[model samples]
Target: MTIKIAQISCGTEYSGIQSEIENAAATVGGKMVYPDVSYEEITRAVDDFGFDPVSPQLKLMIARAKALADGHYDADAVFIASCFRCAEGALVRNEVRRYLQEHARLPVVTYSFTERLKAAQLLTRMEALVTIVAKKELLARERQVGLTAGIDSGSSTTKAMILRDNEIIGKSWTPTGEVIGSAQEVLDEALEEAGVKFNDLEGIGVTGYGRFLIGRKLDANLIQEELTTNSKGAVWLADRQRGEATIIDIGGMDNKAITVRDGIPDNFTMGGICAGASGRFLEMVSKRLRVEITELGALADKGDWSKVNMNSYCSVFGIQDLVTSLAAGHTIEDVAAAACHSVAEQVYEQQLQEIDVRRPIIQVGGTSLISGLVTAVGEMVGSEPIVPENSQYIGAAGGALLSSGFLEGQ
Candidate 1:
């Protein structure tokens, strides 16, 4: 039976749950709906779940969890995915089971956000990790796929990638802490890297933290939601027919999860105005370790991680967890893999089963570029995480493809 599911997470600051749920629903031939809420709001909402004049924070958290299942996500079932259930989870669990006993209407199946995360971390240690589809697959997806340039100018860097024929022709990443100057320079650099002059390209789409401010003057102003661009960019060369899959784009600022099912956008969600479970958090941690972001991926390839002791909800605490692990003689690879697991756990806890969705989830964005992330997420979806060749180009490619109205044509 095709289930209509509402997938929710308690306090995920990232984007994995929603889109992954959408993908999960699609894979299982289910229908999914997304009710958007920021992670902070979710965490706070749990506070009120036990609104029967509950006492103490822990009891209140439990009451709130129960109340939430009773009130907000009144679907057939509630998917309780939280890294740490806290007192809130216990209460939520009690309410769900109680409701089931009294009403006996629908069943509530709980998936541990932490377990999914650990599985992802474990997969990072595999010696024969699945290699991403080769470049030829990307190029073969579409003939004469329009070439476009996506430039993400950030506080510390300007990144531009060229997408053509479903393949990334070239990319340019240069430090431009100042968004203004690098905006102009990176365009030229990206065009050069693609080996194509500006006039030859069909479109140029811009995104990211500095996308709007920078891309306007270039007369190349195709502004898109960072999440959609990120997710679609990641799916540019996937095997889903008619683009039937959800895209999970977890980035520096927040997570943006999009549900593109039945070859149409069913729903999309984003974290609002918070740096919780963000790419910036990872970037900060990487900086603290004096490591490059690219290097972090290769580091996760080593099979050494066994324990990750993350106790904090915030990234700062997460970094501290990393520090503690290092002090305990954890290898760099283990630490990085654990970091990815922590992130996945946070995301899963916040967004899973609030809406029931499908599988074959396509995980994308800078974090998705991490080997550990893809592996961890794959286990979360009960399937291999789909990362396209030129995984980095998914956003750019999606923007370009969407700009051409490719879906409309198909």
Candidate 2:
């Protein structure tokens, strides 16, 4: 069944990414539908929203959102978008998203697009919305009941995990190269460690950048986007699955901040404004400090970030700041702490502002293993983040947990 996704947007046609948006939805077994609203309805919606925007396009956007909220449209999910350049559009997009969440009670995602926006960029968001609609029960499941294996084929690393009756028995993490081969290697390692044959697995799930390709190759039972999966895994790992919590995943190529309720993501924002806010920047900083990435965390814990100035928002400039700091006689530990702090601050400015952050903030992903980065995030959020056991395997664990929901039918 193709999930009907409502497209409530301001300028996709003018920006020349409307087709890209449609194609993304189609690729993920979703059909984009425009909610119909008359001009009178648009006027009424603007009046009811109590903030009339100067742009007529934003007025129409509000009308469509109102129509959805009032049950005048039938949609499984909602996708609200506007051009990045439009401040008014951004305001309307965020308001519409909240409106739908409150009144429509539907799964929703909002994006600020550019003319260069490609379907690849929107695929995960569209896929996640569809997953929330089609696999609601699967995502809501709290525990893994049977033998299941999960593979996370990430941009920089691949990980695999095996779960049996709510316990993770084995897991593997390796640097990613050839996507399929990386996934297979970790799967083999995990299965070997678990002392289980591949055929013994009741269900297999895959996620991350290479999910579609690897899922098709492996015939995965649950091929899902990481937003929902990561939230589920984070909550489950942190033992916060029963309450409202915020999840932060600072990944290799990008970052994700999700607001989840009862283990399911109700709101999420992914992608960074630049690479400087991601794990890749931290990796470069580690190299500049003549330390391994894993060792950078310990080094950062030993120094004060205020001792150096490394506030560049671009990774290249960030590195330049690092070199300048070291040349000025700053210690490597201080430089490392500054780099971590810079990344955390950028994440807060670019992504965290997109949602209402709930507490018992859980930080997951490979970066979470870096105590320095975790500390910086804690400092930025004014709360110490809960880093669960085996946090690095969150994507794989999420896959395994969600896939187990398919076992009953199989």
Candidate 3:
């Protein structure tokens, strides 16, 4: 089925990224349609929304959202977007998102775009939105019922997990090299550890940056983007699938903040302004400090962040600050602590603002294994985050869990 995703935005034509957005949706079996509204309806919608914007384009955007909410148009999902350069456009964009989420109850993804936006940049978000609308029942399944294997081919690392009847029996994590090679290596290792041959697996799922390439190579049953998979894995791991929760995944190249209800994502945001706020920054800190990345977490736990002034938003400048702190005779522990704190603070400032953060914030992804980073996130969020067992394998676990729904006779 071709899911119809409604496009609500302003300046896409002027910005020249409209086709890119449509291409992204179409790449995942979705058709982007605009909600038709008359000028009289636009005027009425502006009054009903109670926020009048000066621009006529903004007025039309409001009317389109209203039309969708009022069932004047048929749509399986909503994509709200606006040029990042416009402050007023952003306000209208967010308000429209919240309004439709409350009234229309459809899957929505919002984007702040630049003229440089490309179809590749929007593919993951579009794919996830399509998956939510098309595979609603698959996402709702709570448990793994058969032997399944999952591979997460991430930017920095590749991980694989094998699950049997709701239990993770084996897994492997390794630095990512050639996408397919890394995925194959981990799958072999995980199968070895699980003492199961490939023929025994009932289903196989794949996710992360290299999902499409590796998924095709492996003939995956479920080739999904990480946003939906991660949330599914997170709630399942944290045992919070039955209620409202927030999921934070501070990944290698980017970050994701998701607000989910009953294990399914209603709204989510991904990407960061810089690598300084991501796990890649911490890896540089570890290299500079001459300690293993795993050891940096323990060292950071013993130090004080206040002792060092490493407050650069760019990863390159952040590393320069790290070197400066070290040259200034600051302890390595303090520098590690400062690095962790900086990333946590940036995540809060950049991505957390995009969603209504519900309680029991579950932090997942490889970064969740860093005790210092996890602690810093807890301090920033005003509550300790729940990092579940096998948290580092969230993407893999999510794939395995979701793929189980495709098992024979399931």
TM-score of each: 0.59, 0.96, 0.97
Reference-based TM-score, model 1? 0.59
lDDT of 2 by residue, 1-410 (tens): 99999999988999889999999999999999999999899999999998799999999999998988889989889888898978888888888887877797787777898899999898898888888888888888998989999899988899999999999998999999999999999999999999999999999999999998999999899988899988888888898889889999999998999988888887788985698999999999988788999999889999899999987689999999999999999999999999999999998987887777899899999999999999999999999999999998899999999999988766
Predicted model with the maximum lDDT: 3
Model 3 lDDT, residue 32, Cα? 98
Q: What is the lDDT of residue 2 in candidate 3?
A: 99
lDDT digits (tens) for residues 159-226 of candidate 3: 99999999989999999999999999999999999999998999999999999999888889999999
Pairs in steric clash, model 3: none
Better of 2 and 3 by lDDT: 3
Scored against the true structure, residue 354 in model 2 reaches a CA lDDT of 75
Off-target runs (Cα >4 Å) in candidate 1 are 1-147, 153-158, 163-168, 239-243, 272-276, 301-306, 353-355, 406-410
Q: Could you report the Cα RMSD, in angstroms, for every candidate shown?
A: 12.8, 1.4, 1.4
Which 10-residue span in candidate 2 carries the lowest summed lDDT?
264-273
